[model samples]
Target: MKLLLLNLIFLSGSAAAVELNADGILNSLIDEFVSCVNDSAGPIHQAAMRLFWLLVPINLVISGIRCVFNGDFSDFFFSLVTSVLFTGIFYYLLSHDYAIGKSIIDSFVTMVDDDYMGPSELIDLVFNIDRQINNLMTSNVLGLVSKLQIVICMIVFSVVMFFVILRFVSIYLTAQILCVIGVFVLGFGGLKATRYLAVNYLKLLISKGLELITVLIITKTGCRILNDVIDATKLYEEGLSVLKHSECMVMIFISLFIFVLSKSLPPVMSSLMSGTSGGFETGLGLSLKKYRFLISRNSGK
Candidate 1:
């Protein structure tokens, strides 16, 4: 029941792009996504700088105190040293407007724009395709079915194109939110019990990177099909049905095929690599398990 409803939602525009920039939609979206990330990330960097002075030392002291209670003197010494070194490295990476963070974000965008989609080639192709559809819409010779085919292809293709770019907005924004909060989680690094919280945060960053790589492969395939559609659209001319030019039928089916893959591929790709994030036992994980057991026990009482 829920699955059917989910499929219905997937077909809707909300699954893809919220807003389309008809003027320079694709590139403008790409540009805007990059812009929004840089803007939101600024105050985060500044706040981290401020907190570097205040919270890091405090966290270290707390960790050091906890270490004394939890471990031997040698263990506490090494943990403090390790925490200081790790924190220093993290701070350096985040310094200068989060060069590391922004670089990671840029790499994802590059994979879509520069690599998979082929910037001008892809965008120019979309424009060319849109212009052809415009021509067909203007043509009085084409019947309803023919016109509907072209219109559906154009709409689905546009959605997939915009979705491919806009998808990163959610990712980058989530990453920004994580950074703002996750910086403090790094403080737990010195304590063995809660250290996994910090480790998991790093793991999540890598997971997002890996997710982009998967999306890049999907985008590459979609763009290639789109390129073929461009070639097929050339087969159209005055008063000719797709029956006469079978290329139009083939093109419509394949273009529609892309929209299905756009929704289906991510979950398939993610499932195949399900072990990427989990599979490790951490002190925090163990503590959470114990905590949950006690909560359940108290509820039974």
Candidate 2:
């Protein structure tokens, strides 16, 4: 059910991208990104590790600054480290033998082919894919499906573990945060000093998530637009395609706009609220309440 909701959310304004055979591309990207970072760290691996840890927070601070200026933060839960994980996973998904890229193209083609029955076509595509998947499940000769499911489960488990580790680290860091607050209370006796740290940390988190989501949305949108632009010349000869389908194109554009807006708004709101004296506390509380309401509403839906 959660997966279904995530899929819907991801597909809200956009069609799924084409399933490119991107295994090589994924590995290459990971290697390049990692190697660049490592090269920047010089010869010693331990020194590199320390520098990387230090740099991660700096990146988050940078993201926060960018978010403040932009007034839009979406998907900021993903920090620099987590964003790297996400990017790697994304690259893997795009590069792997997953026919997601092809499926995306097929969807576009199908949508374009039958303009009048867009909804019905979507349903048919779902069911057709479902039928094929069911057949694969029932056959199970190569155990490919089972292996894939296990891999997915492992990925999910790893994510859960990451969150668990993050929680522990946050808890461990709380003592230092409190110590700083303690010193402030003792030195000049200002409780407001504590507020600064708390607010900044919260801003950091919001900014990070927003930036990560922004990257994902931007990359995905770029891919879709590029594909459409490239296919423009051959769209006529290619029979029905997304670019040829006005309705789909409109939907895609609207969806992308919403994605960009949603990602941008949160951090802007956070930054604005933080700038005022009591605004951060009030806004943070309200945001939390609103988020709770949203979760409840979505859950019910």
Candidate 3:
């Protein structure tokens, strides 16, 4: 039994180690190595590797500032990462001849086969995707309508939350304010007697207000997140329009495509063209030489 197991292991390992064709293996290795190098380089090219590394701290600082103002640091982080991933995926789909679209289609078919989400669920997902896509090409009038909707909804929701917070905060502040007024009304003798009492009362009120406001702002932003999707739609439209108007859309796409194609095409085309040109030059040289030799022979004879 041990001998059979050992033999089986050895046979499997040997099969796994089967040699690949020299040229094919070399080409594949080079393509993969190039991709690895580029991935390691991050956003910029090889020359800016250090610069890109430096941007990491800068990005963190920016995120911190955003968090301070918005108080939704977690949401900010989520949006940042999601946007980067989405843009990278979109750029690949638009620029490359890698059949990314076909892969997406295949995945949908596979999902149906796997009985993951039902057809109705898939249809709802498609509708949401359509809404997002349509949101991009949407006109300013439509954008205004959407923004208005968000504004009204957020304003209403934020007001409700703010007031709920305000009610609690007001109770504390009102008590403190009333006590302060009480001190003034009662005179220095009364305040001196109740100094500790007054300070404690004010401290409690301020602390409660701080806590309530923090919760209120965080809750408000959380409620506004769905509306911010519309904001994203507006931003995307502006960015795409700028690229389109600048006539750089095609160029940008081609530039990105070349990054992928650089692995496969440039060297191949260069070699093929060089060989073809060399052959043509050689044929022309030979023909000219043969004509001269024939002419000389005829003249001498």
Candidate 4:
């Protein structure tokens, strides 16, 4: 594991020295990964479509019966039209392997604060951090305690980085699965009793988008962690208090905040989204929620 970290794709001797290829993190992996997801989801999509086609008529008949008793002719017509329309949309998205899914995530990532570092900047920061660690180790810089601090910070910091990447892949995989199975989910809209299933699925998509944005924001620019590491190192060189200059404890807190609590971000945002009217109609089903609270407070005043 230590060897892997030292030789990590971006953490190598230099950032520009490497290119992602078949032997490493290749572009084909994403294409092939999506291909695999589509292949796996194909059968599921077929089954869902078949079942939906079979059941959609039954649901509409049931809804029509209910509408007759309630004397809601408008409601019957509305349900009939919306069921077919929503199902068609679901089928179309599933057929495309959720191409717009990633686009949504990318849009969320871009919605982050302008001053925050991006993926490219994050990569460069990691490279500089790796070099800094080597520099402190090779030179006669600090006392034993000071060097130990760097080691502790690096270990915790590296774990956070690993989890960020892992969470990203996990999000991508889940979004594809949800997009595919959403055929039946949206098909549930044909009946009033099951309409919430389709609505919740849409909510879940918004939540999933929130999850993707949360992890990226944390690793990309949320904490300024890598900057902290560099700042502490420079302070150590100037003979500051070993404990004071050592931001290892701060590193642990920041890293753990990401590693543990980041999962809650989605559900939290989901709860807030649940409160809003016309969620799906909002376009993207959500605004950039990072600023939503501030937006709310000002409006109330």
For lDDT, candidate 2 versus 4, the one ahead is 4
Q: Give the per-residue lDDT digits (tens) of candidate 3, residues 9-33.
A: 3354444433343223322332333
- Tens-place lDDT per residue, model 4, 1-301, is 2333334455444344445542334233344445545775657656656755666678778868877998855556655665566556655654554455556655776787367564344545555665776576666564554666677777767667556555555665576667665555665554445656767777777777777666667656534766877787776556663434435567667666766655666556646657666545234323333245465568679
Clashing pairs in 3: none
Q: 99-186 in candidate 1: lDDT tens per residue?
A: 5554665575576565535433455566777887687667643444566766776676665555554453344445555555555555
Listed in order, each prediction's TM-score against the native is: 0.63, 0.23, 0.20, 0.62
Worst 10 residues of 1 by lDDT: 1-10
The segments of candidate 3 whose C-alpha lies over 4 angstroms from its true place after superposition are: 1-179, 182-203, 206-233, 236-301
Candidate 2 lDDT score at position 236: 27
TM-score of 3: 0.20
- In model 1, which residue pairs have backbone atoms overlapping below 3 Å? none
Cα displacement (angstroms), candidate 2, residue 23, comes to 7.2
lDDT of 4: 0.59
Candidate 2 lDDT, 15-115, residue by residue in tens:
22312232232223223333333343223323323433444445567656665676644424323334354234333422322133223323433433332
Backbone clashes, each candidate: 0, 18, 0, 0
List where candidate 4 sits over 4 angstroms from the true fold.
Answer: 1-35, 65-97, 100-103, 113-128, 144-149, 190-192, 222-225, 231-250, 257-266, 274-301
